[model samples]
Target: MSLPKSRLLVIGCVWPEPNSSAAGSRMLQLLQFFLAENYKITFVTTSARSEFAVDLEKMNITSEVIKMNHPSFDEMLKRISPDLVLFDRFMTEEQFGWRVDEICPEAVKILDTEDLHFLRKTRIEAFKKNIPAEEIYFDADITKREIASIYRCDLSLIISEVEMKLLQKEFNIPQNLLHYLPFLLEPISEEEKLSLPAFKNRKDFISIGNFLHEPNWNAVLYLKEKIWPLIRQELPDAKLNIYGSYPSQKIWNLHNEKEGFIVQGRAENAEIVMKNAKVCLAPIQFGAGLKGKLIQAMQCGTPSITTAIGAEGIAGALDWNGFITNQPKDFAQKAVQLYSEENLWENSAENGFRIINSRFNKEAFQHKLSERLLNLIQNIATYRQKNFIGKMLQHHQHRSTYFMAKFIEEKEKR
Candidate 1:
């Protein structure tokens, strides 16, 4: 008899837009792993496809549109009967997790929390209020739901070691249930590094991210109001170019060529722009997970001067690609130093290559994850048994969410 094909189902909060957001790039990386393993993957999302959304079909992945809080989803789950179901974010899991639990009891439930939403929310709130982020706690309503989702799932992929530690130390999530899976990137070769724009060839200070992300927009505001003036004061000739996708008119309003604080909207080619830039500045005041622009800066052999928050999770014990300072004055000073000082710039850029190679070896992570998946598949019952809290949450929360969803579905029908 022929063996059955291995199947996987992925529920995305939005269609992948690798060019538009780091989250999108991370999702694509996850897809590449399953593709390499020859898994038959189906991606389902309620989100309408945007022009920027990646064409999964072209990549040999099937995508289907599914409705939220509806019976049709249950039928779709039964029809596919996947070996694994991965939720893109906590919200997606909250909506469809119960159905997956009820329909495909044997399927491994994986929650890929791009970042701890609660932490991001907490930081953003704190930053806006001009207070310390420590004010936020785990008892928030979103925290309750997110942690419960983590417990109920077979495994959750955390992008940062800091977050993985946070889950274990603060929330008491089991080590087995949370895996630290940062950006799975291939190691950069010496040839690749040499090919990147040299310190002499690159110019200007660049920062790039998805403007739709609140933290990125906030960083742009921070640069304009507090950070840029200080830097531009000392190096009057240097320009600070802000590039991002989906920039609104408000972002456009910030553009002033006279001041050289150019709001260059939506990069045509992210890598090309990064490679040509002298220094990348990401003075992020708030957010969670690793920042993609910082990683790209390193990949393109560009040094960066970011904050403690911006450098979080990605730097590990190693020295940062450039500098990490929370103070506005110091941040601006470092940006100038990095842009003008060739020795510092080259050293910082090399440090980035080191971090990427040491921390995010794609092949190593993929092998380990594959092994863990196989073990989980073989011992699903026993694994679930150990997670008693998960079972409890699944039992009670599942029923509550199911009825709530049913009521909404019925209301829609009426």
Candidate 2:
């Protein structure tokens, strides 16, 4: 007889929008992994549903709308009695973690930190002040809250290697509490590479990302104010096509056919647009985590030029797909070279394939995550025993957040 399937509960900040953001894609990947492991998955979120959100029902996963500061959630949690509880981000954990602990004390809690919010926030602040991001204060309020959430969980899935090192080396977080899991992608084969459009067939420079993200918005602004002009000077005929979701009127205003800078908002098919482009340009001044746009470019056999921050944690020791530079002039020069030189473009595309196959093998990461989860589930008591800090944080957080939420719930009722 088959054994009973394990139940997994996921509390999300928002419903997954795979077409609109990288965070959506990452969440879907995790759900798929859990499904593959035969877990009965239920996804709940306090945020209102978006039209762009993926249909979890179609994937055989159950989803529900939940409310905050409500005791009804505790009853729901008790009924589900999940074997594991995965929080979409630190914010989600802060909201529901105390209740989950009270309702299902035995459930293993995990935090999938899509990116370090504190790091990204600090970097953006530094950028605004005309200061180096490296010099920003690391112990901000957000940092403390996020780190506390990390410690309160049994495991925190970090999306970037650089972030993993920062948590360990800089913040002195225990290595056992963290797991490095970047974007999980399929390996590109020779047949797939041959099927991609050749350099001669592809034209123009393309930039695509979700505009809702501050970094993508900032990159587009930087391109318009700094990088695009330099590229226009070199190749006046060449156009830079900008595609992204949720483009504001200000972004649409950047469109100029005469200048060969086009803002085509919200790509219906990201892969098609990416594959047809000769070169991808991402002049990201500040951000955190892996860039989905750059990875999509590589998957489509299109080379790219991005900043050191944009390329961070993705390429490891391997050579980048095209070029890495923060200087606008040098960035434009590389974009021109990558677009015009067929041999260089082909080599860069090849390098991208190597990086994907070697660094982000889907099967390897899935296996690693599966093993880790199983080990944690089996030895949860021992794991929690070793994590005295986590226990202490949970004890205090439960009391503080519980009373605060109770007060709020009572106020709302009144």
Candidate 3:
């Protein structure tokens, strides 16, 4: 006898726009993982669609528009009755997890953390306050909520190994509860590398990220105020191309053609832009998880000059693609050196290929994740039994959050 086909309901915070941001790309990658496994997916989101949002229908994936604190979601969830419910982020889980738990107790709950929200929040706080890394603790309110959400779910997907270690060591989150799933990608072929613009041919330095993210915006400002002046001094003609989605008026205000600082909002083709660039610059002061822009730069055969924080997790026991420095002066100098030296650029690009092949081989990651899900499905009851704390948190949060949602629903009706 054959096993029955599995159904998955993915509640997204927003519709995916893979071209717009790394988070969007990450979401599509996850969806593709399930689709490849022959899992029937129904992607439902409460957020309105963006112009850049990928059309799920084109991929033959069913999608629905959902509402928060509404009874309608329960009915819809009940009708589909997915074997697995994957929350896009902790926020999405907080919104609809209780309803799913109540409606279908047997459905396995999975939280795709994208990146640890609490970790990112803490890093942002530390960066602003100039607090020592050692002083940073789990005192923030987001920490409580995010950790609780982690426990509430049967399994949580951690995208970075650093984050997985942090949760296990600092927070004492059980290893069984979390699984590390980095960006799943195939190794680049020799032909693909040859097709990329050669080091000598590529010109100018580029930086790309979603401007809506605080860290990305901060990095851009750091480049303009401190880092860029030194780099501009070295390469007067070279431009720093700033590309991202939803650039606010303030973002555009910084654009100055005289200074060789260009804020080109929303690249129509992010990869193409990266391909043509000699070097990528992301002087990230604070953030968590692997930096997607840096990864993209590597794939495009473009070396990057980023801070230690920017290069974190992605470069494990290997030489960085270009250079990693915390100082603004050193970062600028490295960017200049990498831009001019073809041999150094090629060596760095080779290191990037090594990291991708060993760390993020798509097939190996997919197989491991599939096995994990299968085991959980078979032994969900026993798994839940081991996670007594998860049950306690779930029991309490469900009761409290349930009433809060009810109050909102009642008010909205009135």
Candidate 4:
């Protein structure tokens, strides 16, 4: 008889909405990986389901709405008895980790930090203060909390290599406790590359991201206030189309037909919109992890112009799909250059395809992750022994978080 399949529990901060945001897409990719491995997967989230949320039931994955600071979760944990618990983000891990430890001590706890929250928060703070992001507030309260969460978990999956280095070099997080995993994507083939809308077929400048993201909103504001006018001056007929989910009234108000700056909120198909665009503009001043919009641009064969922050960790040692510049004048000049020059545009698009194939190949990453996880599972005791700091943090976190949560739960009883 076949042995029982390994059980995997994913505690999400929110239900996966792949169309809405990069975080959502990342969650879905992870779920797909476990599903392919034949793991029995159950996804639980406390967040309210939105219309855009993926139908987990349709995918044959068990999904349940879970409550915070409740005994129900403890009872459910006993019933499912997952062999592996995957925390969607540091916040979810903070909320439910103690219960997981108490209920299932033997289970391997994994934290998937969608991005380093403290890093993004710090960068945004630095941006507001007109300071270099490199001057990060290492002693910030959020840094302490986030780093503590990392230490509490048996392993934390870091999305960016840059972040992996930061955690190791700056915070002295052990290499055994962290794993680098970027967006896993299939390589774009030659036929597929040929099939994409040629440089001549595509038109206009496009910038798309989830507006709920502060960096995207900031970039949109930057475009409206600083960059778009310069690009429009060079090519008066050219339009900059802004597309994203959750555009507020203020974002919509940025639209001006005469100015050729259009805010088209929430593209039904991001790939379609991306494919039709001549040049993608992302003036992301502050953000963390991979920029999915840029990757999607590369996938769609559209060259882009972005800031150093926008290109971070996505393109490594290779020519960028288009141009990277911090100056508004140079940014606009390159946007026009990329849009008008077909040969330059083709070369940049090819560079994007090359980057995708070389760096983010899905098969290579999946195989490596599979091997690492299997090894980790087989040597769980040895792994934990090597991470003594994790154990210490876990002990303290359980003591403090346990009673605090219990108190909240009891108060809710009244």
What are the per-residue Cα lDDT tens digits for candidate 2 across 1-414? 111338999999999988888899999999988888888999999999888899999999999999999988998998899989999999999999999888898889999999999999989999899887657656578888999999999999999999999999988999889999999899999999999999999999999999989999999999999999988898989999999999999999999999999999998888899999999999998999999898888889999999999999999999999999999999989988888899999999999999999999999998898888877877889999999988899899989998999999999999
Each model's lDDT: 0.90, 0.92, 0.90, 0.92
Return the lDDT, model 2, position 394: 89
Q: Which run of 10 residues does model 2 get worst, by summed lDDT?
A: 1-10
- TM-scores of the models, in the order given: 0.97, 0.98, 0.98, 0.98
Candidate 4 segments exceeding 4 Å error: 1-5
Off by over 4 Å in 1: 1-5, 130-134
Q: How do the residues 24-114 of candidate 1 rate in per-residue lDDT, one tens digit apiece? A: 9999999999888788899999998888888999999999889998899999888889989999999998888889989998889999999
lDDT of 4 at 259: 97
lDDT for 98 (candidate 3):
89
Better of 2 and 3 by lDDT: 2
Candidate 1 TM-score over all chains jointly: 0.97
- lDDT per residue for candidate 4 within 286-349, as digits (tens), equals 9999999999999999999999999999988999999999999999899999999999999999
Clashing pairs in 2: none
